[model samples]
Target chain A: MIAVAQPTTAWYLILAALLFSIGTVGVMVRRNPLVMFMCIELMLNAVNLSFVALARDLGDIKGQTTVFFVMVVAAAEVVVGLGIIVAILRRRPNATADDMAELKG
Target chain B: MELFVFVLASAMILGGAVGVIVRNHPVHSALSLVLTLFGVAVMFVSLEAHFLAAVQVIVYAGAIVVLFLFVIMLLGVDQSENLMVEPIPVQRPLALIVGVGLAGVLVTAIVQARSAVQTGTGAGLDNATQTGDHDSNVRQIARSLFSDYVFAFELVSVLLVVAVVGTVLLSRRPARLPDDIGATR
Candidate 1:
């Protein structure tokens, strides 16, 4: 890997794909809701990386603009999700996702 | 130079992502998330999306991860979770298969479309020219955000406010407000 070649868009895209896959696996394998949320964040970041890469590749600003919106949405998501988790855990300490099957309060 | 930075940042990203999943303690996972966020920010810099990179660090690493840590402490669920227990015997294996299949499909699609992509198509992205426009990237993003996506930008503000209010409601204890109102009545 000592070559003086610059990494291409393909390289970045491949990396993003791998990252997204890892996140998916984490979401499925982890029972802890908080950790699962973090994995979702990982997947979001993966998509953001690809968006920026493609923006650079196509010389378009739209990709960056979309990423801006994504970041906002992600923040909102994490807040609301953690809030629900807190509420659930407050009622039943050490509650995992499997324990919260019923939506009733 | 660019190659070196790309390689290093990729390493940071993948390593942190793995750490987030494998770590037993929630706090450790949160810290690992921070590492991945920083790496993504670095990648944004390399891609010349400087403003997004800054926002990424501030919002994701600074605020979001802090919120995660705070929740961890508040809930005291920071204790190590048992990773060995398999509630569903075949779930992990199935998840691994799904992840690998998804990656394969994505990579194949990207490689297949690699040649069809037309580069430098959209009024080339603004970069700092030899002339004094060092903030070209920021300026272009602002122009786009305020002009074309302004409505969507405003909607985001609404979404954020709703999120804040909803979270407050969700986390709030189910006080006997209704009964209190009835009593007062």
Candidate 2:
């Protein structure tokens, strides 16, 4: 009977949860570093979505501000991560994550 | 209308996320990520965080995704990956199990804590109390950012500079030592 009800905060939270889970799976299963990095971005965006939803539900601006900070941090993270990835891939083109075990010794 | 937008955006987000993982090519995954980021931006608009919506588009979709594509092209690693060559036999199944468990736990927690999200006594997030002043969302965010969060804002700027310098050092080729050059000459 709830045909056209607006999405509640809980709906957004659940969606975020699902997205985070997918990202986690991608990071775990994918061997390519670039794909794993994208998965991390997915997880970050999921967290941002939940933060915005809760901010609206609680009538708080702090949550949005926190999301902004999170975005900034994520950008920095991506920059550093991709730089490392580019360096590694440059040394051995098309190297998988498993091949980066040279430092294990 | 709201429900439609929510459902459509959720579909975009989930589909793009799945595509990112399932696609064989890194370029495909990167494009899928763009889809997911845009969907998140749409969700931001639906949540009435208009300024964040704009930023989500600009910073995430515009800047970040383009950077990702640039890396892919620059590296020339756009070849399709082999998804079937699993060195660890149980890794994929184990990851799936872990992901499912995480989603289950989070959904349960959200459902249990649903009643805790009562409307607070914070300032209202309305738009345009007077004519032609329709930027209340951005205005309030700016006030908060410049006031209580100014110190953190400055720290983030510092972090960005460090990241930039570190990336330059990390990605660039190391300079040849003078002795090595003399020996080669």
TM-scores vs. true structure, each candidate: 0.94, 0.93
RMSD of each: 3.3, 3.5
Q: In candidate 1, which residue ranges exceed 4 Å CA deviation?
A: A1-3, B129-131, B177-185
In candidate 2 the C-alpha lDDT for residue A44 amounts to 97
For each candidate, what is the lDDT? Answer: 0.91, 0.90
Best by lDDT: 1
Tell me the deviation in Å of residue A84 in model 2. Answer: 0.7
Interface RMSD of each: 3.4, 3.4
lDDT of 1 by residue, B76-140 (tens): 88889988888999999999999999999999998998888888887668877633688988999
- Model 1 chain A: worst 10 consecutive residues (lDDT sum): A96-105
Candidate 2 iRMSD, 1 decimal = 3.4
Task: Please list all clashing residue pairs in model 2, or write none if there are none.
Answer: none
Model 2, span A7-97: residue lDDT tens: 8999999999999999999999999999999999999999999999988887889899999999999999999999988877776799998
For candidate 1, what's the RMSD? 3.3
Model 1 C-alpha lDDT per residue in residues A1-105, reported as the tens digit of each score = 466989999999999999999999999999999999999999999999999999999899999999999999999999999998887787678888899786654
TM-score, cand. 2: 0.93
